[model samples]
Target: MPVAAKADVVVVGGGPGGFAAALQAARMGASVVLVEKFDMPGGVHTSGLQGAANEGVGGIHTELMARFEAAGYIYIATEETLPEWTGNPLSHYEKMKKPGDRFSRSSFNPEGAGSIMSAMLAEAGVEAMFGTAFLDVALNEYGDGIDAIIVANASGIQAIQGRIFIDGTGTSELVARAGAPFVRGGGPQPSGADWDGRHRPIPGGLLWTMSGVDFTKTAAHQKTAKDPTLAKLIAEADAAGDIPQGLYRPRMTGKGVYGEHYIGHPTLDMSPIEAPDSFILWQNVPYEWALHMDDDARDEARAKSALRGFIDAEAQFLRKYVPGFENAYLTNVGRYVGTRDGRHPLGEYIFSIDDAQQGRSFDDAVTSPMTKTFFWDGFKRHTFQVPYRCFLPKKIDNLLLTGASLSFSYETIFMVMRNFPWCTQTGEIAGFAAARSVEQGIGPKELQWDQPYF
Candidate 1:
């Protein structure tokens, strides 16, 4: 097969990180080609139907949010904004208000946000090949650097050549295929702890949307109905085997901590402001299932099939049991399942969770020191800086890692720095570094972190 397209940078996966990398590289005057299996951009946030900007972010992410806000696609969740959409009196947020509440995230319309992202990529001159899946990669004669990547789409199998390649597939698919060293997620290990690869990874979830919900009725019932808290109803349903066996449940555990789950679904306002009557729901798979779903095709198919069944059950249960969901119906399902943990390509430096909590600074930080990000552990906020070394995958001269697959302890990516803005920041640095390396005619590892690449 002949090479379909050649560019300075070839990016696989057009999620937040991949899209940002392509856009930044193109803006910096490097010819770019980004391939995504989904038809649209904004990976988990768009195609996955989790259109959440969990926290305030800067750099390319800030720009993207600005665009969304301008397009009237964003919904900032807050104490004041909550009641408008659901008609429920804000109790939780009001009680837990803090000085750092300014950094809270906003939700948006997934389809609208995706279109805007596509437009941004095109405007930045990034040639995005949507609905394309990565097949294989061709290594240079020395077997040390990638030369071209094999991808399949409607046009059939083709090769895309580039000087530098970015593995933004979130799971580091490119890096793993190129024979680079990577670490698999080994379920809730401490920062920098060793893993034997025998354990399962963390749990993953699938998100879907339901439309035609009566938010006001739901809120009113939740506040005044006999089972006002929904605890009794959920318990009754669970006892009757109505709720899915493995679905996660949220709990209000004390003041600062709210347990280990997302607050929505059964109660609370998960509806996007664009459509107040629509609710976003998620079904989480247990770690035992997630381990197989990460890399095994057959297992993934099985898990996805099971998840769909769980989603249907949950929808039915909601309509039958929940007061506000009598007329609600499942509308859109995310094309991709959301994984909290998977393969992480090792880099020059593995950022640890301790680094995140302590607000550790690096001499070669790619992130601005003023950028405020937080981890969920007690909701601790920090001004963390990501080093440039984390983007450089070990044993790969021309390949860079981005997104959740970048060098970090599983805890770090899980607890913090895996949000939209952080991933985009990493992509911005990688794209800038890749373009700079190409222009300088040197490997990415040879570039000085402190030097001005631009």
Candidate 2:
């Protein structure tokens, strides 16, 4: 027999969304238990091995930045000290600034992010269960809300109860397991359409880290318009059939952080079905692409083999394209395949591309910001407003979703909100709202968005 524990609120999946929810709810005086499949926190920020935390858009997300800075986890560079790319010095642009001084979007050291996030949750008195996966949800006879959760860990399966539940799983697995009604991909295309209507699988990008990269040397080569020795190396590798072609627009972080762009394909976006008992509010494009793949055993093996090839290609690119990477090596694979999006529960007001482009404002708004839609290549100022209704499912009570899975249209999701920062903000709001719901003994639907709680 497994031991049982209890809490006022339980959060599944310890990513950014789950972390924020657990911290916020615990601070609001709710006893919170945060379950995670990994041994640490920060989700993609740490495990995904993605470069840094983006803080251009602020709020609670900024709080995490402040924490990172205080812990000495950030890199500071200035225009005056900007490394020369070529004969001309590459201009140093301030992306994020601080009060009094200019704040720049400082990239974080992944090694530090996990520790910092864990510390924050500890400070908030959140009981964190690392390496634990939520197996099933137990509901009361009335089916009002989740009564307890069955989880699998090193020991085995254990049941834990809570008054309220928050599903921050990046994939919406919790809600899906709870029997929610969710939709994956847009419905069937018109008849006779060339679209096989099957979700196609694309190559997943490789995540790699390079050290000893002398940003100064590469920047100087770039400024002078000279053949960037680094680029030459990459070209050589590609010609030798080591890396894939079409690798362009490498994203550089200050001096050391860099990423390569690869292939992307359209597929069914993964979104959870809505249920009377639960709601899903986070979704993204990357998740959809992976979920749409054929689930046949042969297909699964092929996908893994393809992923290995992608990783090898990336390793070769680093060795041949950039200077200081001759000694570069693969650091770690992301805990989960790099997923982009998931199922967005149907909410009262689904955010559309028009609303995002128009910078729509709402009377019952929980949060608003001017930001780029996810994965849009063009330069434009697009801001969006999160309506209160979007947080509530039509039938579910005492539930709120945060993270990338919020209700959004395909156009808006593809164009905006794909960036990770947007998900952080939504997660913070959902966390605060969940705490309020528990305190008032009412469902999130009952709370008036216009009313001032603070």
Candidate 3:
């Protein structure tokens, strides 16, 4: 096959991780090429319509948020407002009607974020090949390093050669294709039965937004609306076939939404983003359907098709039943469903939940100690650190792992570190390591972990 391009580092899957990896490497004076399946970067945050960043400490994440704010592309809720709004519930309804505090917890315009990603990559002299899909890898003579990757795009099948490759595919697709060992079926199950694809991986969801919603009326109704009444409407919708079949229960995580059980009251479920009339929402699929992710492509496609059906049904139901959504319409649907967990390429160290809960630290730490922010309200908010060894594939000499594909066990730790900010941090570390490895004429594993690189 013809060689499409050559660079010092080649990054696959231009999501948050891959995008940061490519950008950082190029900025470090390495020739970089980033390949993405979609037309834009930002992965789930863009194409998947997951436009929110709940937490960010430093690094590219904070910088990106600053740019988004300057460009008028984001809505931010500060740390102080975060607690106050959660306390008063109705405060979110009022606050969201106006501008937010600053860029702490943020929701952005996905397209605008994508444009920013493109501009950053371009400015750093990185060749970003969007609309390109990874096909396979070409191994070197020793079978320990990748010489190039085979890809397909509108330009047809071609090869992208690089000295070092980073896999941010979120499913460890590159390492899997390179014949490296990885943990699958929700990571280190005891019965060994889950590895056979019998058990579901992490729960996956699809996000979409609706415009022309009346938040004022929705908030007023939420103040006195009874759960029994909303549940009855849902039952009626199901009876009338307005709701999708096979348990189409969706929950809201957007602005102006009150309480955790917003699923019971669909009117209070949608979260406002960018504008008061615009809101983002998501729905979790059945366990049987979620099990297909990264294992069976055909089945995954079927699951997505079912999700689209749910989106249509829910949109119609909101317009007909909800008081505030009398004329609500679907503003946009995500390009694809976002998978939370999948294949994890095994590394020298598999960061486990125990490590996270204990707030373990290592000499080879690549990331600053991060707080325990995922799902567990009761667990102590201890800080955990990620080491550089977690990014190195055990069998692949020239490949590094980032994003959800990193060598972390599936559980609370994955949920904590899998956010866009954390993923970008991992990418920053990996990119720096790859560029240094190329410059020093050594494998990534041989490099000494330097704290200043972070």
Q: lDDT per model, in order?
A: 0.74, 0.57, 0.76
- Models sorted by lDDT, best on top: 3, 1, 2
lDDT of 3 by residue, 127-193 (tens): 9999999999999999999999999999999999999999989888999999999977454333332
CA deviation > 4 Å runs, candidate 1: 54-56, 76-105, 187-198, 226-229, 238-241, 248-259, 262-273, 288-290, 370-378, 451-454
- Model 2 poorest ten-residue lDDT run: 267-276
Write down the lDDT that model 1 would get. 0.74
How do the predictions measure up, each by TM-score?
Answer: 0.86, 0.75, 0.87
Best by TM-score: 3
Clash tally for model 1:
0
Model 3 misplaced stretches (Cα beyond 4 Å): 54-56, 77-105, 187-197, 223-225, 247-269, 288-290, 374-378
Give the alpha carbon lDDT tens digit for every residue of 1-454 in model 1.
Answer: 8799999999999888998999998998999999999899888889988877544466788888888889999876543434433223222222234422432336788999999999999999999999899989999888899999999999899999999999888888898899989887664443322235355565566888888877567656766765545666678788988887654344323322123343223433244434656667666664434345567788677768887987888788779888778998999888977777788778999888677777888888886563444444656666667788889888879998888879887766773667777788778888888888878988889988884221
lDDT of 2 by residue, 136-229 (tens): 8876677656668899998789998877777777656666566654555333222222145554222233343434444555555544656533
Arranged by TM-score, best first: 3, 1, 2
Regarding TM-score, does 1 or 2 come out ahead?
1
Model 1 lowest lDDT segment of ten: 86-95
